[model samples]
Structure formats: structure tokens, C-alpha cells
Target: MQLIIFKDYNALSQQAANEIISLVKHKPDAVLCLPSGSTPLLTCQLLVQKAKAENVDFSSCTFIGLDEWVGIPPDNEGSCAFFFRNEVFKHLHFSASHIHLFNALSENLAQECAAMDSVIFENGGIDLMLVGVGMNGHIGFNEPGISFDLYSHIAPLDETTTAVGQKYFKEATELSQGITLGLKHLLESKKVLLLANGNKKAAIIQKALEGEITNALPASIIRQHSNSIVMIDEEAAVMLT
Candidate 1:
């Protein structure tokens, strides 16, 4: 595990983008795990701008969504798929066929999980997984108390997550469950890039990176991975020594 505290969000996003751009440059077909939410929005934008400026090729890179709210339509504004489509995919020069995302509306949820798991398995596993730590230390929807041994599975959303996530919806939305690539999948990645911004994330960021490894704080488990990097703005890094 490695830690990098930047002066502000832009700097953090730039650094993160550079790292990802480097990966795609070296391996255009690299499989990437991406996240939604405001924290990573700027980073994805920067990645697009940089890739365009450098004429970096992303036509062969594969993108995999990390999680999605269950029961939501893929086209719904609140769905992770919609968020990524508008935020990341629309900005990339990648092939549409290479974009893999969890099916939150799958009638047979178990089959959905199995299918996504198989996709990851067939892709030779994720080469780079970009993540964002939630205010409660949750990673993807693997909330506190989630088993680290699990693979792609359904997760019940934490209260804190539901409340914090409400802002994404156009109106009132109740998200009770989520479909996510389990912590095991994230930990198994060849490289992990986790980002956090804002002073509101300061305390949890400190705990996740500097505190003990435990499932109770899902992001803390990143400490167990051999190739994980954490990037945070100074505000988010305020609690760190």
C-alpha cells in the first residue's frame, strides 16, 4: 500500500489520471474497474482530456463498473451505469463492446453475479481498479461487516451510504441493495488506485490507510493488498500525521 496527499482535488485528479494513462499506454487492452460519484468525476474528466491531448489510444481498453444500485433501470439517472455512461464512457475513445457493467436489474440476481464474475475471470482479472472511499469507509457497496472473502455478490446498503447517495437521484430514491464486485475482486487486482477528496472524508481516510486492517472498514482492507495506492487531497488527508 502507498499513500499520496496532494495540495487539492485538481492535483489529486491529475496525478491519478497520469497513473491510469500510464497503464493504458503500456497495455491498451488493460481491464479497469471504475467507480461513480463526485469524488472520481473530476479524475475521469481529466483522464479524458489528457488522453485526447496525448492522442492516447483507448480503443482496446476494457472498462468494468465497480458497483450499481439494485432494481434501478440502466438508463435511470441514479443508476451507476447511467453515471458511467455519461461521465466516463462518453468521454473515452473505447469500443462500446469493451464496456462491461453489472446488471442491477437482472431478474435472476445470482445469475447476474455469476455472469459478471465470469467476465472478470475471462478477462485475466482486473489490471487496474480505480476506487473511491465512502464517508463511512465503505468501498464499492461492500459496506461495514461485509466478508472480504466474497466475490461478486449482492450487498445491502449501509444507512450512511443510502443517505449520502440520495444526492445522485433526480428526486426521492430508496436504495436498499447493491450489486458489486466484492472486496476480494478489488484486492485481487494487479494494481489499485483509491482516491478521496474533501474534508468530510478526512477522518475515515485516516482510519482506512493508517489504522488496522479489518472488514468493518472495508477500505481498510486495501492495506492487505501488495499493489494499492491511495491518493487524497490535503483536506481529506488532514487527519493523517
Candidate 2:
């Protein structure tokens, strides 16, 4: 894994946006797995702006959502699908056919997992995966103790995840499970970009970078990936040794 620390959040977001734009420019059809939530909001916004200003065509790229809360509708404000639609997809005019996201409302969630795995496989695996680390060091919803060998699966959300996830909604929403692409997919991706910011993330960022590679800290598994980059702002990198 490689680490890149920026002076501040804006610089980190700009660099992240630039990396994504450069990938799309070089490989218009690049398959991407992206995360939702506050950490990536600025990056997604910058991406939309730069793509529009520079005439970056994203209609050809295929997008895969990293995870979604179980039982949430795609249109719900707190859903990962909604986050992408409002922040990136609608603005970029991404083709519906090129987008693959979890249907958290599906009766057969196992089938949903299978479908996601199929899409990733058919697309020759993910070209790039952008993820954010949770306070407990989870990636996607792959909480502590989740097996790194698994692919797309339903995960039991960690208590920390359940608590932190509430910030996405306007009111209290019970969040217990998540359908997510597993760490296996992240490991197999051609490139993985892990983004973090704010002093709140400093200690976990340090652990994810310097701690031992173990399922107890899912983000630590990124160390095993041949081409993974950990990009964070100075505040988030403060605790790094």
C-alpha cells in the first residue's frame, strides 16, 4: 500500500477527483466500485465538476455501489443509491444500464449478492475501487472479523457502524445489516483508493496503515493489495508513525 497525505481536506478531495478523472480519461469503460457517506461527498462533487468542465465522458463507465443498508429503498435519502444519484450519477448522466447497485429491498438478498458478484466477474473485475474507512476500520460494511475471502455478501453491521450510519438520515433509522462487496473484491481490483479525512479518523488511519494485517481491522487488509493507495488529509494522517 502507498500513502499520500495532503495538506487539507480540499487538497485530498482534489487529488482523489483527479485520480478518478485520469482513470476515466485513459479507460472510458473502467468499472468502478465507489462508497457513499460524508467522507466521499466532496470527492464526488469535485469529480462531477471536473468531468463536466473538461468534457470527461462517464456514460461509458460502469459503476458499482459498494454497499447499502438492508431494507432501505434506493430512493430513500439515506440509501447509498440515493447518495450516488444525488451526488454523482444524475449530474454525470451515467447510463442506467451501466450502473449496478444492491437492491436492499429484494426478497432474495442472496440472489442480490450473486448478481453483484456476476457483474463484477463479467466486467473483468473492478478497474478501480474507492472506499472510506469507518471508525472501527471497516471497509464497505465488512466489519471487524469479516472474512477477507468472501465476495459480495450480506454483513451484520458492527455497533460502531450502526451508530455512525445514522448521520446519513434526517431522523433515527434502525440499521443492522448491509449488503456489500466484500474485501475479496477490493483485493482483486486493479486499483484501490482508500480515502479518509478529519482528525476523527486519525487514529484509525494510523492503525490501518501501521497495524498488523488482520480481520479485526478490515482496512488493514489493504496492505496485502498489490496496488492500493491510502490518501488522507494531514489531520487524518496525524497519528501515523
Candidate 3:
């Protein structure tokens, strides 16, 4: 794992966006797994701007959502699908066939998990996975105590995750479970970029980076990935040793 501390959020977002742009430019058919949240909002915006300014082509790239809140419709403002649709997909004009996202409302969720895994496998695994670390040190809804051995699966949301996730919605929404690509996918990805920002994330970022490697802190498992980068702003890196 490599660690990079940026001067501020904007710098961190730029670096993240640049890395993605470079990846697509080098490998037009790169398969990506991306997270949705406040931390990645600026990064996604930057990607759109840079894609246009630099003439980067993303039409051939494949996108896979990292996770989604169960029982929510994709069109719901709070859903991960909605976040990507407005932020990256529409802005970049990504081909519909190149996008694969979890159907949170699917009645057969296990089948949804299988389909996700199948897609990842068929695409030759994820070329790059960009994720945001949750306040609780969770990555892609692989909350505390989640086994790193698992692939795509339905996860029971931790209380901390359920509570913090409310900020995504305008009105109160029930957030109990999440269908997500698991830690195993993170490990298997050819490259991984983990982003975090704000003072609120400092302590958890410290724990995930400087503390023991354990499933209790799911982000810590990134330490074992052959190629992973943990990038954070000064505020989020404050607690790091």
C-alpha cells in the first residue's frame, strides 16, 4: 500500500481524478469500480471536467458501482445509482452497455450478487477500484467484522453505517442492508485508490492506516493489496503517525 497526503480536499480530488483519466487514456477498455458519497463527489466532477479538457475517451471503459443501499430504487436521490447517473455517467456520456450497477430493489438479491461477480469475472476483473472510506472505516459498505474472503454479497449494515448514511437523503430513509462488491474484490483489483477527507474522518483514517490489520477495520485490509493507494487530505491525515 502507498500513502499520499494532499494539502487539501481539492488537491486530493484532482489527484484522484487525474489518476482515473490517465488510466482510461492508457487502457481505453479499463473496468472500474467506483464508490458514491460526499468524498467522491468532487473527484467525479473533476473527472468530467478533465475528460473534456484533455479529450479523454471513456466510451469504451466499463463502470461498476461499488455498493448500494438495499430496498432503494436506483432513481432515488439517496441511491448510489442516482449519484453516479448525475455525477459521472451522464456527464461523461458513458455507454449504457458499459455500465453495471447493483439493482437494490431486485427481489432476488443473491442472484444480483452472482451477476455482479459474473460481470467482474467476464471483464477480466476490475482494472481500477476507487473508493471512499466511511466514517467507521468501512469500504464500500463492507462494514466492521465483514470477512475479507467474500466476493460480491449482501451485507448487513452496521449501526454506524445506517446512521451516517442518512445524510445522503433529504427525507428519512431506512438503510439496513447493502449489496456490495466485497473486500475480496478490492484485493483482486489490479489497482485500488482509497480516498478520504475532512477532520471527521481523521481518527478512522488513522485506525485504518496506522493501526493493526484486521477485519474489524475493513479498510485496513488494503494493506495486503499488492497495488493500493490511500490518498487523503491534511484534515483526514492529521491523526496518522
**Least lDDT summed over 10 consecutive residues: which range in candidate 3?**
132-141
Residues 1-241, model 3: lDDT tens digits: 9999999999999999999999999999999889998999999999999999999989999999999999999889999999999999888978999999999999999999999999999999999999988878899989999999999999999999999999999999998999999999999999999999899999999898889999999999989998999999999988887
- lDDT (Cα, 0-100) at 115 in candidate 3: 96
lDDT of each: 0.91, 0.95, 0.94
Please identify model 1 stretches exceeding 4 Å from their true place: none
Task: Name every residue pair that clashes in candidate 3.
Answer: none
**TM-score against truth, every candidate:** 0.97, 0.99, 0.99
| Model 2: CA > 4 A from native | none
Model 2: weakest 10-residue lDDT segment is: 204-213
Number of clashing residue pairs, candidate 3: 0
What RMSD, rounded to one decimal, does every model reach? 0.9, 0.7, 0.7
Find the candidate with the highest lDDT and give its number: 2
